[model samples]
Target chain A: MSSEYDTTETLDVKGQSCPMPIVKTKQAIDGLEAGNVLEVVATDSGSISDIQGWADGTDGVELLEQVEGDDLYTHYVKKTE
Target chain B: MSTDNPTTSVDDADSEVDAAELQALRERVEELEASMAAVDDGDDQQKMTIVATQGSFDMAYPPLILASTAAAFGWEVIVFHTFWGLDILHEEKSQDLKLSAVGNPNMPMPNALAALPGMDAMATKMMQKKIDENGTATIEELIDVSLESGVDLQACQMTIELMEYDEDDFYDGVTTGVGAATAIQHMAESDVQLLV
Candidate 1:
């Protein structure tokens, strides 16, 4: 369902909760080169706002979009630095 | 000769006005540069300081959760575990921290029933079960995340001495025996401060 941006990596945090979604997202983005996009799949409902708020406050990363499926949340993050 | 004097004065006044405008523009550019640099350095990084004063099973989550979350946000986070809060950083104590139902109003049972001999154990077990069922991060897991994310975990010196806790009792990477003065200094310098 994600076709807008070419995702460089996909991080599966489907069952992780709270800080793990964001923490794992950060780690994934860190390993990526600048301009690379990361796709995050999560089951935690809080990841919607958590990833948004995290991207809003953090530098060198941009949250492109969030796709909500039947039971999963997909977040597209771009490493801007 | 009179014409020459007027022309000379006008030219002189025009040059003086230009010099004043140039100086003002220069000062404005310097001010803008300084603020831009501040934004690059100071505004980019924020600091948070928290004083954790409780050690119950329920109470332990807030500090660690907030600390790890803040660290994820790229903020410098410091959590000072004082008094009963020191139990959270204690390797053995943290794993076995109990939920006391005796004085807790949140418990559904009557205070009398909650004060029964085995109530604390039952409550602790119930909460642990809930945490497991929900897939929530355990206290130990949160501690690991906080450390891995570079959150500064500090233990109160006075509490360690009063409780006769060995310095080795705390988890690795925790800054043990930190004085109140150090905690206060961090709080003063932090952009956000909390006591929980």
Candidate 2:
């Protein structure tokens, strides 16, 4: 799926379960500079809410967009200072 | 007459109102200070401490799962292994941790099948396979991930001493051997504390 926002990096966490996807996503986002967009693609069904909740709880990160495709979910997040 | 002092009466009323307002402001300040103090006490909302007391394959997952997940959330996670739970931290014994199907209510089959001679081994293999198929990290992998993410892994000193197990018996990531007091300190500091 296409994201309106330009992503600086894409983290593919496909086939990973609940916490692993979130964990890897967090780690991936941590490496990027502020204002960079991270596109996290995952097959875990729970990643939809998990990523949203993670973004909500975390500071300096904003959920820009979410795209759901067949058996896959992509989360677009922008890191803010 | 006192009624003639109208300005004085007005001033007196104004002063009484001022006094009440001052009291209310003081009370509000005190309440805010109390809450701030509570927050400063390090209720450790961003920290988690888990006590792992069981070593079975079924039992080993909880602490590792929680510790890793908590670390994933950017929380400071600590897992304290005591007694049988230390087996998960042991280099060799960890591989031997087995799931017993005989009395497990969650086992699909009847007790007759579960009671078969080698069923425990079968159940353990099944459990491990299911964990692998589900994309869940193994206990060893979880421990490694947790450590790499800065989760603190501690062994119970009392148990280690009682068991006569050397520190070499545990995996590389086991950071410290601490007594109940240290574990209790972690629990007290953590907002999310679990005994598994």
**Residue ranges of candidate 2 with Cα displaced over 4 Å:** B1-45
Among the numbered candidates, top lDDT falls to 1
lDDT of 2 by residue, B60-179 (tens): 987887787777677888899999998888888888899989878899989899999999999999988988898877777777777888888898988888888899998887865598
Candidate 2, residues A1-81, lDDT tens digits: the string is: 655788899999887786788778878888999999999888889989988888887767899988888999999999897
C-alpha positional error of residue A7 in candidate 1 after TM-score superposition, expressed in Å = 1.2
True contacts kept of each: 0.67, 0.43
Clashing pairs in 2: none
Clashing pairs in 1: none
DockQ of each: 0.64, 0.45
How far residue A14's Cα lies from its native spot in candidate 2, in Å, is 1.0
